[model samples]
Target: MAEPELIKYRSATGRWVLLATVLGTSLAFIDATVVNIALPEIGRGLSAEAAGLQWTVNGYALSLASLILLGGSLGDRFGRKRVFMIGIGWFAVASLLCGLAPNIELLIGARVLQGIGGALLTPGALAILEASFVRDDRARAIGAWSGLGGIGGALGPFLGGWLVEAGSWRYIFLINVPVAAFVLWVAAKHVPESRNPSAARRIDVAGVLTGAVGLGGLTYGFTAWPMRGPGDPVVLISLAVGVVGLVAFVLVERSSPQPMVPLRIFRTVAFAGANLVTLLVYAANGGVFFLVVINLQVVAGFTPLASGIAMLPVTVLMLLLSSRSGALGQRIGPRIPMTAGPLVCAVALVLMSMIGPDASYLTDVLPGVVIFGLGLSLLVAPLTSTALGSLDDAYAGIASGVNNAVARAAGLLSVAILPLAAGLGAGSLTVSDQLHPVYRHALLICAGLMAAGSVIAFFLIPNRLAAHAPADTFCDPCSPPLRPADTVRSAR
Candidate 1:
């Protein structure tokens, strides 16, 4: 096969493509963090109970977590640029609706719509970047995307706090409109359209349906159970339906010629293991942040802005050191970093679990945040690189989509279940006395999740860096001599 044309790393087109994708996906990343910061404000404004706030957040995650694979599949089937632009437009409209929403019900509905659009665009952004740059430039481009993406996600709380303090939380949604418009313009003009020719033409409609129903049902059932009581018919039926839908989804995928998930990918132990680690680790990460910010505001008397700013330690560390972490992974292999990183994070969570009504930011919170940030900075790049490296390049989009779906699903379940397990419900989330004990328990649970992730990585992830590392490769072992085919492939 002939070589495809390369978009030089220094070219104007490459820069624009990177810019557009960075901005496009940044919208979703920002929303994920900012909404947590805004939750207390959202609760006050909407007169929403704990159950309502959970729905407000979970509604979006549920849709995104469930449909993201389908979204990636759609982009591969159609043109990535076209689908991405459409998603940006859809997101803009949804954000506008959210900013203008008059009631909690309407806001939740708009948030779901926003997630659908986000799912459509987020995977395509990375996919497009992967396809656009030459192999030599791909790693650097992805590094930039990953680093800047973290910055974007981190910016949410700072921005949301300012907006909320300035007298309205609606601006959080309103701000995305102009940003989305800019992304649309840059994408339509600069991004190249690409798709996999070998990709199946058949749409996985059933897969999408079953996945959504299953995830949404479980999230709803778990989140509502505490508020609705043990015998609530709606909760019981939802749980039952969720289980049935999940089973159906698996059966459907097994039989389908063009499965959205392509279960065969899990045949690689590394791929399966990485995703399991992602699920456990990200679940803990998500639940910890959710509980932390709320605790800071409700129990510790920190203002929304102060609580948001409290996380700057983690965000700043990630932005500064993530590239070095990536290089470290490439040097010594991912196993050490992946294993050690989660354990460090577990320690940080343990420290965080000690915070109480009298906790100080400098002594208690900052230490945990700094340690957590350091651990995360080490984990994310290596974790992602290893997961994607486990598969052939042909399946890059699908691999990323699957991993993303896992992360989001982990977050969705964590947010829903953690509070209930911590004994939080309805009107009790805001009461400092009731929430303090629950918060402590929740943090310990989160720490255990992270520790479990570390154990999984230690057991499952191979020490080699390359996707096709030989059977005998050990941690820190030298790269095996390449066969002729590999030589030619590497030259290309």
Candidate 2:
């Protein structure tokens, strides 16, 4: 297979392409966190169980995590721009349906649809950016994308809280409609199409089905087990099916000629280590975001608006520093920052666990939030750069997709299992005193996970400059070196 000639997009063209990817991916990132702030409101409105509320979040994440690899492969085979536009359209429609849903079941179903759309656009956005820019510009472009995307995520809780307090939680989904429309228009008008010419064109339907079924069953089992007793037939059946399906997926992937997730990438120590760290760190991160907001609102007597703005420290830090961190990671390599960042976050989480039911935000919460935010600012950009940087450009889409899926899966499982693990099962979510202990336990557990991540990074994440002895030797020898100017298959 011949490498496709890369096109150097003009400065103006790069700006538009960046705009579209940032906005397109932001739709998914924002939606992921925004809904968390509204969960309390939605639960109240719908008279939903804790498990039902969990499902509303996990259902979307499950679908997105399961299908994202396939989505990336599709973009690599088909045109990335075309697939991205289709995803945006699909997401917009699903958002509309979510806003209109009157019951928890319908809303969860709609959210699942939304996740499918998100899976398509999310990886394609990163892949498109990677293909559009030359290696010299790629790091900077990704930095900007990461920083701006962090802002979108930071804004979600604030926006969702405002909506939930002033009007309805439905507006959270409705807001995406206009944003998606603008992204679709800009992308179609200005973005060029690109695909991996050497990638296999065949879709892995069996892989897709088994993966989805596996994720769906596991998410369902975990989420429902808290509400329905562990002994319930539904819980037992779902867990059994989920385990079987996941095992089957591994077998199928092993046998398939062109698997969606090529098992060979795991052979790269840096790649595998980065993803392993991703799983642990994000699991902790997800538990904090999902549980902290709800705990603040329900236990601490915070209003929706206050709860939403409480995490502003994280937003401020990321928006200000993530781009710089990305550049720093490029120069210094990812090992130091990745190792130190999670340890800082672990300390912050331990600090956060001290906030009791009658705690003050300034004395107890703000300090922890600030430290946690700083740790995150240090970690996220470098983590992303390292994971994708280690892979060949040809596998950029799938690589990004795999990492994204791991992060989502982490959040999905944490949201489902953490409350139960913390001993705040079924009827305890809304009670102030009951949730205080849960918050403490959950925060401590999260801290442990972050600490473990730090340990893993210390041992497994290689300092490529020191180890490989060449600045551009980050990728595998099988692929081309990461050069300043690399050709992409582009239809201008």
Candidate 3:
């Protein structure tokens, strides 16, 4: 079959394609951090314990992280538009289920289903753009997509908080339904269908299953650890299973002809270093995004709306400075930005740790948030560029996929493990006295993680990326780049 002709970025079809992809991707991106703002309310409304709330967050991440690579491969094998629309429709249904869920268990289950849909669509959004746009115009289209999607991310917390305060926490999930429906309609009507003709026919079933089991087991074990001590047999078994499953996943990937994760890519020192930094940085990020809003509301005596808006400075800073930061990195090299950015974030985390009862937003929160935002604005682009640039062009898609999965998994594991490490006992997240100390401890731990990441970046990442690396790979600090242009060819 002859491939569809590429379109210009300025055309009406291009505009519609960009709009559909941006909105489609936003459904997943916004849902990620937005739910954190509504976590306290969700807990209260559903009578959920801390473990239940943690699962509510991690469940979505677990499925998304595990299946995202597979999702990309499926899109390439079948059709990008077909899989993307299916993901949109599936996500909408799951969101409806989430809104109507009668109990915490059902809500968590619905969230897991929601993540499956997210995994399906997230990669396809950028892949579609890469396939549909003319090569010369692809960068601008992706840049616009990144910037506009950042706006959705910036609005997420404020929107989620308002919805929770004005009505119910359920509205946060319910709202995706109409937006998704519109996206579906636009996609079906105007989006061109494309797939990788050379994509592998056989799916990596073993790799997918093992990876899912590994992440699921670890997330479950840690999430259950706070309520059930590590000494518990179930905890021990789950941990063991998680360890075993991850090892098995590695083995399977090593042997598979078309692995979801090409284990060989880790041979590049720069690629490996970049991902390590991603792991530590994103783990810290997960802790902050998960706990900060709850801390503001529960301990600092702010309303949901107030707490949600507190972090706006971070988003704004990233929006304004990310592209410039990417340019700076390109000129001076990524090493300095990557090294210094996390150090700045560590300092910000230390400041954030000081927020306590009666803390003023301006005096206590805003300063830390601003510093954190600046650090992220500096860090994300270079880190993403380095990750993609460290590898050959052929491995770009897999590298992006690997880095993204690492970030998501880091967040997932951090959400599960941070509370346990901080000595947060069962049912303590709501109590000011109980949560305050835990929050402080957790933020300090997160600070240490950021600091560690900086050290890794200093030692491991190179001053310059490969000569052939994409020149324009900037992305929103809130989410990693879905697929950078010139890096979108299927890794398979």
Best candidate according to TM-score: 2
For each candidate, give its TM-score against the true structure: 0.84, 0.84, 0.79
- TM-score (C-alpha) between model 3 and the true structure: 0.79
Q: What is the lDDT of residue 163 in candidate 3?
A: 93
Q: What is candidate 3's lDDT per residue for 1-492, written digit by digit as tens?
A: 222355667777788889999899899998876888788988888889988998898788777776777776677666677788999999999999999999999999999999999988887787676666654455456556655777798787778878988999999999999999999888877676666455476888998899878876776676566567778998889889888989999999999988877787798888999999999999999999889999999999999769877888887887777766766776787899999999999999999999999999989999999999999888887786677667644344455557767887788679878977888866579899999999999999999999999999999998876554221221223222233321233211
| Clash count, one per candidate | 0, 3, 0
RMSD of each: 7.1, 5.7, 6.2
- The sequence of per-residue lDDT tens digits that candidate 1 reaches over residues 1-492 is 433344555577778878998899999888866787688988899898887787777787767766787777777666566778888999999999989988899999999999899898888787776555654455456656777787788776778878988979899999999999888777766675666656788888888899778866776776666567647999899889888988998999899888877788899888899999999999998898788988999888898768877887887787777767866776677789899999999999889888878779999899999999999988887787667667655566677778788887777678767887777655477899989988989998998998899999998888874543111111111222222221122223
Q: What would you estimate as the lDDT of candidate 3?
A: 0.80
Off by over 4 Å in 1: 6-15, 32-58, 100-109, 133-143, 164-170, 229-231, 420-433, 465-492
Report the Cα lDDT for candidate 2: 0.80
lDDT of each: 0.78, 0.80, 0.80
Which pairs clash (backbone N, Cα, C closer than 3 Å) in model 1? Answer: none
Off by over 4 Å in 3: 1-19, 32-59, 76-82, 97-109, 126-150, 161-171, 185-198, 297-299, 392-397, 420-438, 467-492
